[model samples]
Target: MVMAFRKKPTSVIRTKASKPKTPTNWLHLIKPMLMFLCLLFAYVMYSNWSSWLALLDKTPIRAYALTHKTQFTTNSDIRDLLSKEPVLKGYFGQDIQEIKDKFLEIPWIKDVAVRKVYPDRISLTLVEHRPTAIWNQTRFVSAQGVVFDLPKERFNADGLPELYGPDSEAKKVLEAWYKIQKDLESRNLVLKSVAMDIRGSWTITLNNHVELRLGRGDWLPKIDRFVTIFPEIEIPDGKRLSYVDLRYEHGAAVGFISQ
Candidate 1:
């Protein structure tokens, strides 16, 4: 065997070449996926909540609960007026403006404020017209110079001044009356009534039963002139001043009560 046994050839095994693997970061992908799922869940919840709220708004139980919880307080006249209206209609469907219009239809209501409280209530505030004087014995003149009428039994007109004039001349007559009243008040005189006849002639009755006739043109100057000379006029001892006619150009005609 030591003699050269013809060296036997050894066979080498062959293997396939493998490619390099790239590392994958699962944390980044998982973070974005979790964020997307959370967003989707939140959107679904919000949509459901919105739908529930809308349904609640139209529910009859909600409207009934609000109706029972509503509170209203006003004068008897306003209350009576409100009683004629369909005020208890479905609360959610009730028109606030319609309520306000109904309130304004009342003759005495000047302005109305309506408010709706959340989840169940309504509030109303009413401003009533204040009558300053009686107009033509049928209507009333408000402090803002508006003419309106109401039930005679609703208000006391005992001490108010009686202002008579054509319907178109109400404001003018009121202004003149106010001016004359202010002027006469400076002389310790009280005006009981003011009247403007169909001929546009002005007349005033005093608290002392004295009547003053002021013809149409430039009566203010005559009134001023009379105010200036009133204190200087002298009456007979047994007589009292009864009437004054200021229709003259320069002077007034005075009448006296016979004792």
Candidate 2:
């Protein structure tokens, strides 16, 4: 009977697998978190607003005014008001950024900063532009070439070279002329005038009206060679040399004054 009896067929059941969670659907979990954060932020803002308003209501305006004619006593009064406990407010009447912008607009002020103290006082720092030289006949030029003008009585530049030329050429000519003057100093000679031709050629006149023509190429070597030969040349009696042409490759030519 046991051999004849077959085991009952087991019931077979297939169950569907659960789907994998995608990050896109999981984003719903952050909604509650964001709502909580927003509520907390609102509460904090309300608290700070109430505190600031109460402090401002008690602050004194007359004492905080910044006026040029006011005596030092007024400033002391303001300072005393600001030093009170629980951080009295409304002393900084203007926004710090606005105050900084206003100060920067001043002619001499290059930069400025404003800081709020714990109570009511403000701290200020300023940077002024340093005058380097006079630009043209009126404006002052800083070391960085920023031009501004002040009353002549306010500044002085007795020894700075007076530069005159077209606006486009002034800077270039000034730099070139300065270099030429420096080179002249090595020979114990001082240049009187370094005038540029219409074509931008450089012509230098010495103290004695002895002119030199230095054509476009680097003129230092020519100047050096000419300096070596200058002392050797002897001018004819009653004939003063007018111009020395140093543009030639090998030798310098001198134009003599007609006797």
Please tell me which predicted candidate would have the highest lDDT against the true structure. Answer: 1
Misplaced by over 4 Å in model 2 are 1-37, 40-93, 117-121, 165-178, 190-259
Scored by TM-score, the top model is: 1
Off by over 4 Å in 1: 1-76, 85-87, 118-120, 152-154, 224-243, 250-259
Candidate 2: residue pairs that collide: none
lDDT of model 2 at position 193: 60
Looking at candidate 2, what is the lDDT of residue 163?
A: 41
Deviation (Å) of 112 in candidate 1: 0.5
